[model samples]
Target chain A: MSLLSVRSLRVTYGGIEAVRGIDLDVAEGELVALIGANGAGKTTTLKALSGMVRPAGGRVTYKGIDVTGMASHHLIRQGIALVPEGRGVFARLTVEENLAMGAYTRNDPPGVSADLDRVFELFPRLSERRAQVAGTLSGGEQQMLAIGRAMMSRPRLMLLDEPSMGLAPLMVQKIFEVIQSISAQGVTILLVEQNALLALEAANRGYVMESGAITMEDAASALLESPQVREAYLGQ
Target chain B: MDIFLQQIINGLTLGSVYAIVALGYTMVYGIVQLINFAHGEVVMVGAMVALWVITALAGSGTTLPPLVIVLIGTLCAIPACMAVGYAMERIAYRPLRNAPRLAPLITAIGISIILQHLAMLIWSRNPLAFPQIISNPVFHLGGATISGVQIAIISLSLLMMAALTLLVYRTKLGVAMRATSENPEIAGLMGIDVNRVISITFVIGAALAAVAGVMVGTYYGIAHYTMGALLGMKAFSAAVLGGIGNLAGAMLGGMLLGVVEALGTGYIGNLTDLCHVSWISSDLAERCAVDGHVILFGSNYQDVFAFVVLILVLVFRPSGLLGERVSDRA
Candidate 1:
């Protein structure tokens, strides 16, 4: 059985249908990438799965429990964390406060402390600037803080949306490395990226989304080698 | 010098009242961005209730201890105002949360009107007299005359403000409030019940307003139905002067406004009269000055000061004295 499964998920904003009947499954410890161009409903898909946007149709099941229409807060407690698009860091808050906010639902004080240490260890840059307000951080540091914040939640399944949206090439590489490291630590990852080449390279499995639907799915390596995927998304 | 000292004390005590009420406005605005027009009514209700309770005690021809009267009045106001505040948030504010911002503003205005009339209905149009126990003793400090009521009101209000600061900065609820204010969606995702937090904020704010109401009642020796309107407008000005969402700014703004009002009454009075003499064809500047009555912006200038401060703050520094830089629309 898949660790997380989303079936026939449809999300609509007003009359515009953004994500139309998309199904996905991620096995335990799998690094699954959802790659598409802008407006292809990549962010909407991740949002639906994390309960940020209530699905208009179908179910999102995590470890066999349907979380459709469940409050996003409840889903977080159930161990699904989404590092939202644009890296929504609280600008007024310190990096430390942002991390503590991620652990807001957790009651185990020692575990929260342990997770904070781990996040700092994962991104030493964050530790150095933990006292600084997040708004003052460079874009790359904010992205790292966003990911670090998600990590602080100790999610069983982590959803990352456009983690490399506005980063230097070196920073993008660093972010992918962090994603890989997070996956290695036994957390399932669902990464959405517009940078298809980098995302497909980093992911174990890749799903190609287009116009609010899953157009293709295969092993990341196979998609990287596929003529259609390479021509359309990989910019080959 | 003695007169100057006297005016300063008067200013400080009055300013203390404005500051206390302004803190409530700032706290509510900080988290919810709702003007909470009913907030002033909350103050009015508190004062009226305290007055009625005091009057009842006094009407029986048995005098309660001064300390006990003050204490009961204060204690009664806090919980009563808190309940009203919580009910307002839950019934009126919460349902309109997802609605357009203007909807809540309109609702709050409506609530304010309701509360004003509610106070009038309960207390009648007459000004309720405070028990004379509050003004029993007048202490002389150097050359300035200081009353016990003034000292209690000023010191107690400051104590409440300090306690509020501590609660906001140090407690778990404060953390939750900060989180909700920063980002409600993210805060909810973190299991901070956003609505519950908002309600708690209202309760806390109202409790502070009640404390202010009790203080104002004791010091002024009267409570009237229309009192909240003037106090509300002044507190709102204080909130703006301090920067709307900034907590410490509200307190500062309140005290500053109090001082300014006192100084205006004392020194600026003659200066402003000079303006009246120089600039105005008595008809024009007088019209623009406070009320159109007698002197010093006529006698109604006090009512206009709050609004003048509000306009000036908005025009000069839109972000306020301590601006919270909100995220710009992408």
Candidate 2:
């Protein structure tokens, strides 16, 4: 069974429909990329899956449980964590405190502490400035902290939204490398990105979304070589 | 010199009460940005609850130790006021959370009115004498005389403020509260229960207000339905003066306002007398002296000083003495 299954998912913002209808599936331990243009509903789909937005219509099942419309916090307990769009770090909190909050739903203190160490190892920059307030961190560091915070939750399935949104090219490369390592650790990932080339390079399978619908799904390498994808996304 | 010392003590006591109440305003404002005008009514309810509990216990003809009686009254009042605060949030404020900013504020005023009337209906408009649980044993510090009650008020208020500071800055729950205050939507995305955190903020604020209410009653030896009105406004001013959303700012603002009022009360008369203003004229001064009053300004004008300080603070540093915390977005 797939780890997450979304069938005909639809989301609306007031009178406008942001996500018309889409179907997708992620098996356990698969790294899937949802790549699209600015308004192709990639972010909306991620929001719906993470329970940030209620779907206008659709069934979202996680591990065979109908978990659609469950509140985001509840979803976290079920081992789903979203590292939200634009890296929403708690700016007022210290970096260490931000990581501690990531483990909020859990009760095992020793396990939480171990996860804290693991997050620090994953993002050494966060460890170097753990005592510093998160707001003062540079953009790249903030993104790293955002990702590290999600990792602290020990999620079985991680949803990353625009992880490389506004970063130096070098920082973007580092973030994608971290993503590949996280995927290698056996965590299923659904990564949403406008940086299609990097996302496809890092993902095992890729879905191309345009105007609220999936236009194509194929192996990442195959899509990278496809003429239409090369012309539209890879800028070849 | 003795009067100066005495006024300092008085100022500290009054400031502590304002600090406690201001914390409620600051915390609620920090989390939801709601003025919570009903907060004053919560304080009134707390005092009334304590009064009722004490009155009931007294009427039972079983004499309990003074400390135990006061403790029981406080314990009962705290929870009663917490329930009122929780209900106010859930029923009046929560529904209007997504409404325009003015909606929750107006609802808060409406709640304040409802609570005031409810207390008046239950306790009547007459002022009730608070039981003297702590004896007033006078002790001299330098030239000023201090009472046991005053010491208790000052020490307890300081202790509570310290504990609250530690809770906000040091605990796991504190992190959640700060995160929610920083950004509710993001905090929820981070797996924090935003609603529960907001509710807890109200509960903590209400509990602090209740303690302040009981302390005010004990200090003044009287509890009245209208007592919270002026106190609440003063505490609100204190919160704004210290920066509405800053915790340390609230405490500082409260104490500063108290000290200013106390010192003004103590010295305004003497200062006016020494000035010998031409506007008063020699003849008017002579007549005033004949009437056993030589000064144009007196303790009656002490309350004015608080407003003047508030205005100056607002005009000069609208963000407050301590800078206000701005919610940073991604």
Candidate 3:
């Protein structure tokens, strides 16, 4: 059974279908990448899965429980966490407060404190600026805070959307390394990115989406080697 | 000097009530941009409910203490207003969340009217005397005097404001509310129920409104259906003056508006008396005469000062004194 499964999930904005009947699966502890062009419904799929947007059609089952159209907060408690694009850190809140909000549903104070310390350990830069408002942080630092905030949920499955966007090459490398390390620690991840080369490198398996549909699915290396993928996404 | 001190004390007491009411207006407006015009009516409902409870308790001739009776009445008002606030959000505004912005604004006015009429039907159209349930002992402070009710109103309002500050900045719910206010969709991504946060904001504001209701009724010695209309407008003005979306702004706006209106009403006749225009007709000049002035407008024009200040604020500083919080774009 997959840790996260999407079967023919469809999401529409007004009249236009953003995510049209897409099927996706991420096995437990597996790092899967969903790579596509902009406007290919990658973000919409994640939105529907996290219940940010109501699905126009389809079903989503997480950990064998059908969670289609469940609200985001409930999904979050069910151990599904999404680090949204554009680094959706609470800009007005301090870095520390932003991280505390991540563990909003948890009641175990000691466990939450432990997780906070772990997040600080993972992103030492965040630790130094814990008192500063997130809006004041540099782009790379905000991205780091967003990821670290998600980690505070102690999620079983993580959905990361374009963590590399608007970041420098060095920061992107650092973010991907963190992604791989988090995956190595036995967290199932569904990574959506425009940078297919980097995404495929970090992923165990990969699916290529084009025009709201999955056009290719294979092992990460196989997708990397495919001439079509190399032309369309790899920019080679 | 004594008059000035007394007016200041009076202004502060009134300011406390305005601040409490303004919080409701600013908080709901802050989160969803809905003015929640019905919020004032909730304050009225709170006062009316308290009066009804007090009237009933007195009619039964129970041996309960006067303070205990007033306390019970106040306790009843809180939940009643909270329910009113909740229903306004859930039924009147929530369904129209995605509708045109004008729809909610218009709906708020409609709800305000409906609540006013409902109160008229439930209670009386004319002002009813709010019983003097407490022995309001006046205490001298410097040259100014502070009554027991005034002290209670000021202290209670300050306490609520402090609690609100703690709630907004200190609690998990507070962070969630701020996040929702900043970006509802992203807050949802962070596992916040934006709708719930908005509802809670309305409820908290309503609770404050209820307390203000009791305070106003006690202060004025009357519980009238229309009282909330003017009071609500003044509070709204205060919120705008303090920068509508900022919590501290609402508090500051409210207190300032109250004090300004009080002082304006207290001295407007005298201030107008100072204006000596020699060229004016004797009849009109008498109204603004140099020495022996005809009292053109006295404290009876208390309501006018709030609107005048409001006009001045809108014309010069539309963002408000604290400046409208430029929260990041959703």
For residues A1-236, what per-residue lDDT tens digits would candidate 3 score against the true structure?
88888999898898998887999999999999999999999998988988888999888999899999998988998999999989899898999999988888788999999999998998999999999999999999999999999998999999999999999999999999999999999999999999999999999999999889998999999999999999998888
Q: RMSD in Å for candidate 1, one decimal?
A: 4.1
Q: Which ten residues in a row have the lowest lDDT in candidate 3 chain B?
A: B321-330
Interface RMSD of every candidate?
1.4, 1.0, 1.2
- The TM-score of candidate 3 is 0.96
User: What's the TM-score of chain B for every model shown?
Assistant: 0.89, 0.94, 0.94
Estimate the lDDT of model 3: 0.90
lDDT tens readout by residue for model 1, B88-200 = 99999889887888899999989999888888888888888766665447889878898877888789888988898888777667877888888888777666778888999
Model 2: per-residue Cα lDDT over B1-330, one tens digit each: 499889999999999999999999999999998898889888888998998888788768777877777779999999999999999899999998888888898888888888888888999889999877666899989989889889988999999999999999999899999999998877887789999999999999999999898889888999988888888888999998898889999999999889889999999998887335534578776666676456778789988887898899878887888965443310
Candidate 2 A-chain TM?
0.98
Calculate candidate 1's fnat.
0.55
Ranking by DockQ: 2, 3, 1
Model 2, docking class: high
Model 2, TM vs. native:
0.97
Better of 1 and 3 by TM-score: 3
DockQ, Cα level, model 2: 0.80
Question: Model 3, which residues run further than 4 Å from truth?
Answer: B278-291, B324-330
